[model samples]
Target: MPATRRPIRQLPDELISQIAAGEVVERPASVVRELVDNALDAGATQVTVRLQSGGVRLISVEDDGQGILREELPIAFRRHATSKIGNLHDLESVATMGFRGEALAAINSIADCAILSRANGFAEAFLLDGRTGELRPVARSVGTTVEVKELFYSTPARRKFLKTDATELAHCIEAVRRHALARPDVSFAIWHEGKLVEQWRRCTDLDPVIALDQRLGDVLGQEFLTQSMRVQTIASDNNLRPRIWGRVGIPDAARTRADQQFAYVNGRFVRDKVLAHAARSAYEDVLHGHRQPVYALYLAMDPARVDVNVHPTKIEVRFRDSREVHQGVRHAVEDALAKPRSAGLEVAAQLDSAPLNNGFSVEVRQPQSVPMYSAQPGIGLVSKPEYRFGMQPDMPGHKVSDVGAIWQRETAPVADPIPQEEWPLGRAVAQLQGIYILAENTQGLVVVDMHAAHERIVYERLKNQLNSITGAGAHPRTIVSQPLLIPVTFAATPDEVATAEVHSETLVTLGLVISPFSPRTLAVRAVPNSLVQGDAVSLARSVLAELGQHDASTVIERAQNELLSTMACHGAVRANRRLTLEEMNGLLRQMEETERSDQCNHGRPTWRQISIKELDALFLRGR
Candidate 1:
């Protein structure tokens, strides 16, 4: 069937605005985000958001910022009219959050909107109504107040898609929370049904880092400050490159979901894939399985290098060079988490203080004469040791046995005591069941999981050895490939086959050789030397999926880490192997020097500090 051609014409003003509204406004939260963007762009130092019925019935955003001129108040509601940018050059390097000018027009189209404002230098104030296009004199301070009533009233279909009032209110609060996190210099408050829901006060600290930390503590909670490490990385003499600064939660603080991950570019929040992928990759060596890391990373770079106008909502950005961003974020997070938390004064100070340790002294105790186990090659658990080594035999019936001497502390002169500050993990005092190493520090008891701690130390050492073998270069983590005795084939999707063929060189670096055996089948004839026993088909699938989404180095490093982790778990010192005082202390020294020694490769905590206050409470001594 043939249809007659119609002439193309410009759409009506109301229809055009409504069409733009569909993209700018998803729900009440969308309106809240856009309005807050405008308030912050106006140089607002304090912003108060009042909502009714989850902002569907009423939304009033009052900001103490430079208000609009009375003459320009009416034009502010017109589509494509904005004071943010002048032309294409301004659009190219947009520094403001709301420049598209589509938010006001789009929001006004579906809701009854009003703006009451008094310009900075003007004494008079005026109120402009969007529906009637009426302006009248009003009394107000030197600021702006924008009220949106009956959202989606004109478009009832959009209203039906919204969730319950409670869910919508939660989303609206989250939108404001994002803004508050980025700006510690500004105070924010949210009110629902005339009751205050949330508030974040402005920080007055002179140091930006301290102010940001205080803000994080207030918003994310004090536990975040205690469990996270500060991250600050600047590019070397490159002004255009990104300068990242924020905090990343320790491996032990990893959550089940990714809700706490927040990334901002030039003070504007964004959900960039490159930033998310880079942050996740940095935690691959420490966090295990489906655990998601928590971080609040703020990236500051030249505004010209990023295109924020790509999305209508301005929540997503397109970086001119995404590789630079990925590398910067990944390295920043990795460096911040490289050092163990136990070695830092920040963590030590966070421990509860008590007077219970006032009379505590370092004691060097002798080991009990218990049957000790010998190292069994390739064994990961306790082995039988029925006989003692280097035992002098008794001649016939003449026995010279003094078993008590072996368990007695030597009566030698004590050496000078070493300062506790020098040994953060402190001196090893005892070993509990050959499984835990208990030490004493200034803060109090330090309990270490011997097997888990040794596993992490061994894993780091293995990684360092691999890095040395590969050397520092573009392909620094190149894996050694091992040919398989028999090829493993699997039915592969076309996308997977395409990814395998296209990234053949990259796959080779990861020690994988996947090739097409048939139109619908792929064969993996080789794998990484360390992972030769692993399932080749599954390895190939994982590598292909990683290559499809991330760069070659990400996949290479991840695959190498998995192999090293398994090897480390197998090679670490086994449980139930009693250690001398010297051996235990040496292990503690190694742990203090090792990277990420606080947690094992499986994201389990390797060490814990039971503070003096905690001990006092446990024994009821504080009372």
Candidate 2:
């Protein structure tokens, strides 16, 4: 053994700091979370967070709590320094939310950090500079105030990932709010870009929720909160007993993404796909596909069973018993969503209680002539069948009518009243209950629903051309269109104009080009090829309707889809009649070749998966 010595096994300081920073700081919100947690841990009854440009430029947190001693000031900036936990044994069961003893160290490495502190009886304040870990005595201060300046200055790459100032500030406020809710005894305040964004009076009761609703008025706007539901549930197991408490908004209440589904594991906000997905699945039966619900679920479990120490920033947790947690979460969310609307504030299903003959309108005594465009007379979930375009298992299957002589029984209807333009596809043999048309064809039997057929046609056109056109414009989307001589005008608000820009190109592709003729007047011209000249204004208005009704990121595509869907609805044959063979067969052939024939333009499926063999087995004629 010739002096076996490992030659300088060491990692770079920069690399070490980067790795440490990974655990301590993830985003701007993470920075606020750690500071807030530390303030609460210090026995602070009230804390205020001020941000400059979404915490990217500056983040300052002040707390009126028992401050640190002069001698301990330098150690607070060093790594592995904390008064929250004492030993390695504490790691096994972390009682406090922030006890990794790494947040300050990691944050200081990337952002310029400063901490000013003073004890209860101490007359003077002590300052700790993270850049140098130098402690200097200052004249006068009575509490701790931490200011994080030039956040991520050492890591420009990380700063690049931050969202708009407005969005980042929103995230910062949201994080603070969630904790404020968890610790109702503590008060929280927030300021962004010098403007006071939100403030909360110290209250332990559930009333803070209403105040939060006010702060997030734009996101949890009245429209979304209007459909909210309250939830509470419990779970018990061999080694752990957990309770989940919070309110869950309906699927329609979600803003844009699943980001609205907030969950706190032991008072720490976490970002988890599994937990969010489980919460989403619980509401699938009631909401549309891919549409998430707004929820605030707090999981209080044995500290030992749930580990929040895997990362420094702690936006995720490792559940010792995920199944128990999942079950509890799913049950709570489902139960909340299932509950009927609260008394006196119910969302009416329909304006009229009864149905009228001819299926044209309701309220026969008034003698109205309006047609029932939706399944329900007015806008309601029950009337908007999610599976009307196809078979989604979310809704019932549709029957095809009329076919070739061999399938002639299905197509018995389209004998009259259809426009001359669509008559050439095939003779409508039958109109099945006014919703479907059975047409006979030489190649195969075709079954068509007038509504679904139109949707398929429009969806294919949009799907094929959308991606290519969205990025070709000067402003993220190119209008491949020409403006009209006299711009069609519509009254709208500033928010609507902003939403319109996101979908502006999609509007052009759908054959309309709009611009703000005035702050409130939007000028529209041209229309989709499928839309008649006179129908342009109402169709445009309807597109706006669908846009407002939906929480879509791609407002333009959503608006366009709405227009096409509306066209499909109007073009779809009225329900309750008979159809012929030729018309139904044509529909079947068209659906087979159409892209996404499985789902109509608005997310409804168009076909069922029942195999021909299954049809034979039903009759006891199996081979």
Candidate 3:
């Protein structure tokens, strides 16, 4: 049977416009985004949004910016009419937020929309009905106000998809939050059901740095500013002109959901995959599994290098050179987070400076004397006379047994009376249950998981040694490979086999030898000497899986790190193991010098600083 041929006919202009609206206006939030983009593009300094019934009933956006001329009011709602870009050159280097010109036309199609505007030179404003094409003289300020009423009223099917008013209103608020964050100089206000919801005032300072921080505090709350690390970087390479700057929350402040991460490019909020992945990778060693990092990163680059027109809503962007952008963002975030923090000193200072009625001071008394353990030679404390491996006779008791004699020969004793500010972790005062180390610093207290801290220190040292042995730019020193006495064969997918073949050089560098034994099978010849105790077949498969998923440059190192981490965990001091003051202090000093020492290999915080203000609050001091 032959199918009936359908006639090709042009759709009506109204229907075409409505079809376009489906892509741009998904919900109340979508309308808010489009309208706000328009306002921002118009050079609005102050924007006000008023919503009713989650914008399903009405949405009013007023902006103090350059308004459309009276004659252009009618054309503004027509399809393909935009003032943002006039030619191909403007399209390539788009700086304005609303360039597509489809927003107004699409939004008007789904809802009853009206625009009231008075141009800069006009004496009076004019109003136009989007649906009826009716224009009339109206009195208004020298700005623009767009009113959208009865959203999806003409299409009951679409209205049925609307959620409860509260849920929709939350989404609308979130949309506004993104805009407010990107533009710290602009003031934003939101009203829902005639009640004020949120308002962010313009920053008073003209300095970009101070203004950004002030605005961040205003929008994200002061706690975020206190808990986050400031990130600012200008690309060092002459070829790349991208500048990335913003704030990333400390690892302890990680959230369960990714809702707090906000990224902007060229002052336009976007959810780009490259940017998200870059940020995530930077926190790879710090954040625990299933925990999402929170950050507000801004990237400034030549607009010609990015395409914001890829998405109808303008929330997604396409970078012309994704790798360059990814590296730039990753390096910027990594550099900021890698710097040693003064624990939570900034936060503690803020709390301490806060106004209080009572004028009482909290004091932290120092330990009168170091608790002396019974002189048990070679047990918990190693006295100077007992130090055998080139130990200085005048040295204090060193906890040699905990880390073995290797540390004794390598590290020198730390001088006494260390400055409080010089070493934030401070000197160890006592051990708790043989599992935790309690230290006193400028801050009230620092509690450390001894095993966790030691594990990280050992892991970092191992990696550094490996890097030194490999040397710079030379092929990594071949990890000694042990030939398997009995060859092992395993079934592999074609993709896995292809990955093994493609990354053969990378595998060799990691001391793995894999070959295709047959069409569907792979045979392992040798494995790294360090991982000989592990399942060679499984390790080979895991390495191949990693290679297929991530860049080859990092896959081998990551695989090696996992093995090193396991080794470190076993070598680190165990729980219920007593230590002398000297041993605990030595460990603390090592931690201060180690990179990423704040977290263990498994992304768990190794130590925490409790400030005096926090302790005072707990005791209800100066309430």
Q: Candidate 2: list runs displaced more than 4 Å.
A: 1-23, 120-124, 132-142, 152-171, 177-181, 204-225, 234-239, 342-623
Better of 2 and 3 by lDDT: 3
> Stretches of candidate 1 above 4 Å error?
1-22, 351-418, 469-559
Give the C-alpha lDDT of model 1: 0.76
Residues 8-42, candidate 1: write the lDDT tens digits.
Answer: 12334443343213388998999999999888888
Number of clashes found in candidate 3: 0
Model 3 quality (TM-score): 0.76
RMSD of each: 12.9, 21.5, 11.0
Model 3 agreement with the true structure over 536-614: per-residue lDDT tens digits = 5666777787678766667656676764565455436667666767678667766776777878888887887766787
The sequence of per-residue lDDT tens digits that candidate 2 reaches over residues 37-106 is 8887777878889999988889998887777777777667666666665544555577677665667777
Kindly give the number of clashing pairs for every candidate. 0, 61, 0
Worst 10 residues of 3 by lDDT: 1-10
- TM-score on alpha carbons, each prediction: 0.74, 0.51, 0.76
